[model samples]
Target: MIEIKGLHKYYGNHHVLKDINLDIGEPGIYAILGPNGSGKSTLLKSIIGLVNPRQGTISVNGISVAGTHAYRNEISYLPQIARFPDNLRVFELIRLIKEIRNEEADESELVNLFQVESDIRKRLRNLSGGTRQKVNMILGFLFDTPYLILDEPTISLDPVSLTKFRKIISEKKEQGKIIIYTTHIMNLVEELSDHIILLLEGRIIFKGGLKDIYGKTGSSSLENAISMLVDKNGK
Candidate 1:
């Protein structure tokens, strides 16, 4: 379970996350939806210990995230933007990550799934944006952790790759892992998310299942529902 209580965050004088509280105990896909600068990424980063909150606490599986590195080992995070050493090859980077984590990995399966086996020998700077995104996906999934966090995961993915990505995510969910992701793609959210957390101006305006959101907004599609929320909030 991921527990977040009274969380608050700030950047200089600007507050980002304010009095946030959530309990994600179920093993399913949870989509975090919000407009830009609504504190979605900040919230996710705080859970992963990449960002520090000014108040409150976050814990995963009863382990507190405050001032600890062990809790992070249970999480696999895919950031919105991934930067790697330009001189390193794809396989080298993968090997380096495995060594750093000092854990067994079956990245070869992911390489084959993403059709990036041939590109593994290529240098990082040589891969295209979409190809790099595929590599990023492989790296994120290689660890097979219980908690997965993805940010804009479909960026630069081709239709075929996107389909594969969805299948992989579904497979992980079937294994009873807790999955949380942030995406602007409503269709993907509608198709995969079992629950939704809608944030507005650093606060969660709505948090519930897809059916609940639809009922509240009186909209048939996820995109329109979110639009209604934004319009109602004057965002």
Candidate 2:
């Protein structure tokens, strides 16, 4: 389980996250939604121990994220943007990450899943944006961690790959792992998310299922509910 309490963060007089509190205990997909500067990335980084909060506590399972790096082994991250040396081939990057992390991986299976075999020998500079994203997906999913954090994961994906992505996400849910992701696609959220966390400015204004949002905002659809909520909050 992931638990957060009284979280606050700032950056040179700008408050990024405010007194945020949350709990994620179930095994399902949870979408974190808000506008561009709503602190979604900050919250995610905080949980992964990449960003520290001035005041608060974050714990995964029973381990605190304050000063420990071991807890991160339980999480696999798919960054929104990944930068790599253009000279490296696709497979070389995979091998390099596995060596750096010094953890067992099943990347061969993932490569097959994404049908990225032909491009494995191709250099990073040679791949298209969507193909590069496939490589990113393979690297992120191969670790088989209990917690997966994906930021803007579907960006630049082709339709066939997108379909495969959804299928794999559903499979992950069935395997009883918690998947946390951020995306602007409402239809994707409606299709995959078991719950959602909405942030306004630096605070979490809402956290619940789709039906709960509908009830709270008196709106019938997720898109309308979010629009109403953000507008009501003066965003």
Candidate 3:
């Protein structure tokens, strides 16, 4: 389980997150939604211990993630955009990630799943934007770790690739992994999430299942409910 208490982050005098408290358990998908510059990304970074919060406590399965090796090995994070070595080939990138994790992986399975084998020899600089996103997605899920955090994971994906990625995420969720996805796609949230956390400014305005959200907002669709909530809060 992942627990957060009194999480706050600031950049000099600018506060990004305020008194954030959340608890996420195993075998569930949590979709975090917020407007631009609402501290959504900052919260995700803090959860992964990539950015230190001014005041907070974040732990995964009883282990603190702030500068701890044990926590590092248990979580995988995929940023909104990824940069890879321009000279590295597709196969080389996967090979490198597998080697870094020190885990033997069936590279072909991942390659076929993402449909990137034809471009195995292509360098990162040569691949298109969607292909690079696919590569990034593969790296995040390759280790099969307990926790996965993906930020706008489907931004540049093509329709076919996006479908494959959705299936992969569903499989991971079924495996009892804790998946926290930060995305603006409400349709995806409705289809994939077990719960949704809605944020306004730096505070969480709402947190609950889809049915609860609909009931609260008097709307049946996820997008309508989110729009209602965000608009009401002046987001």
Candidate 4:
């Protein structure tokens, strides 16, 4: 389980997160949604210990994120932008990450799933944007971890790839892994998320199941409910 208490973060004079208290105890897909600059990325980073909070505590399965690096072993993160050594070939990058993490990985399944097997010999600089994104996905899921955090993971993916991505996420959820991700695609949220955390001005304005959000906003669709929330809050 993940526990957050009194979480607050600041960037100079700007407050990015404010008094965030959340408890995630179940294994399912959680969609973090907010408009630009709402601290969605910051919140995710805070969980992964990439960003430190000014005053707060974050723990994963009873392990504190502060002043510790061991907890990261249980986490697999996919950033919004994946930057790798351009000179390295796809397979080389995979082998390097495996060697760095020192963990057994079933990357062949992922590589086959993403249909990147043919390009494994190509250098990172030569792959197309979509292909690179596929590679990013493959790396992110290559390791079997208890927690997965993906930021803008569907970016640059085609419809067929997107479908495969969804299937992979669903399979992970079924395996009892905690999946936390941020995406602007409401249909994807409606289709995949078991719960939604709506952030506004660095605060969680709404946190509940999809039906609960619709009921609260009196909107029929997830997109409309989000727009209504934004309008209601004047954000």
Candidate 5:
């Protein structure tokens, strides 16, 4: 379980996260939806111990994230933008990551699943944007950790790749993995997310299921419901 309480962060004089309190004790896809600069990435980073909060506490499986990297072993993070050495081949990057983690991962099946098998020998600079995103996705799931944190992973995926991505997500769900992602695509949110964490201006205005959102806003569609909630609380 990931528990967060009274979480606060600041960037100089600007407040980023404001008294954030949340608990993620279940296994499912949780979508963190918000406008630009709404502290979504900051919150995710805090959970992974990349960003420390000025106040409050974060605990994963009864272990405090403060001053500890031990909790990171159970987490797999895929940032919104992954920068790699331009000269490195796809397979070389994969091998490097596996070595860093010191864990045996059979990326062969995943490489084929993402249909990037042929591109493994090519350098990162040679791969297209979409293909690079596929490689990022492949690395994210290769660990099979209990927790997966992704930041806008589907930015450049084609329809076919998106379909395959959804398939893998469902498979992960079946394995009871806790998947948390941030995306602006409402269609993906409507289809994949089991829970929603809506933040606006560094505050969580809503956190519940899609059905709960529909009922709250009295709107039939997820997009409309979210718009209503944002409009209502944004002021």
Candidate 6:
């Protein structure tokens, strides 16, 4: 559903992304794992057109992402750190997000999805960090876009809420949505990803399904398997 070809990004003398090529298929969660400074965030930003690559091309559903807002409507992204107006109520913030996306969201649906009915009137600043993360998660899922890019989405989320969020994502996957997730948590990657893309020194060293990783590492556990890959290929 998404293709990135020969992508390259640089910061002065330092190269961040190097000749990266990726094909992300639909209906499955793709996990991107890399050490810090390996350009995982840079790759995500490039896909969203927030960071322009010095080389290569990105296309989504047969449309080029060079200079168009049309492609933006097809995807939703959740950054690692999300900040909202401290004074805005939960419902008000959600309403604002829906309006910004030019979407007519179902309030009750969101309330049930995030279980925010009782908390809707509370200010964002008064909410716990986990609840704030929930708000961000709901906003990312609100529009039901075809492609979702989530970075450290489980951070600050309570175990119950994380489980609920996982269920929601699983439902989305069953519906054939494309998901790209980035995180340091190996366990979540094992549970959620069908394909794993490992980035090392600004380039992809491994790209294949989880089963392929298992076979390559000769490990039964996904975490142990990925640890092997990371240890071998990551810097």
Q: CA RMSD for every model?
A: 0.9, 1.2, 1.4, 1.0, 0.9, 1.7
TM-scores of the models, in the given order?
A: 0.98, 0.96, 0.95, 0.97, 0.98, 0.92
Model 2: per-residue Cα lDDT over 145-205, one tens digit each: 8999998889999999999999989999999999999999999999999999999999998
> Residue pairs in steric clash, candidate 1?
none
Model 3: colliding residue pairs? none
lDDT of 1 by residue, 153-226 (tens): 99999999999989999999999999999999999999999999999989898999999999998889889999
lDDT of 3 by residue, 145-175 (tens): 8889999999888889889988988998899
The candidate maximizing lDDT is 4
Score residue 195 of candidate 2 by CA lDDT: 96
The clash count of every prediction, one per candidate, is: 0, 0, 0, 0, 0, 0
- What would the per-residue lDDT of candidate 4 be over residues 1-235, giving only the tens digit for each residue? 9999999999998999999999988999999999988999999999999998999999999988899989888999999888888999999999999999889887888888889989999999999999999999988898889999999899999999999999999999999999999999999999999999999999998999999998999888999999889778863
Residue-level lDDT tens digits of model 6 in 117-211: 77889999998888888888888887878999988888887788888878988998998999898888888878888889988889788889888
Q: List the residue pairs that clash in candidate 4.
A: none
lDDT of 5 by residue, 1-235 (tens): 9999999999887899998999998999999999999999999999999888899999999999999998888999998889999999999999999999888899998898889988999999999999999999988988979999999989999999989989988888899999999999999999999999999989999999999999999998888988899898977
Model 3, global lDDT: 0.87
| Model 2 global lDDT (CA atoms, 0 to 1) | 0.92
198: Cα error in model 5, Å:
0.2
Give the TM-score (vs. native) of candidate 1.
0.98
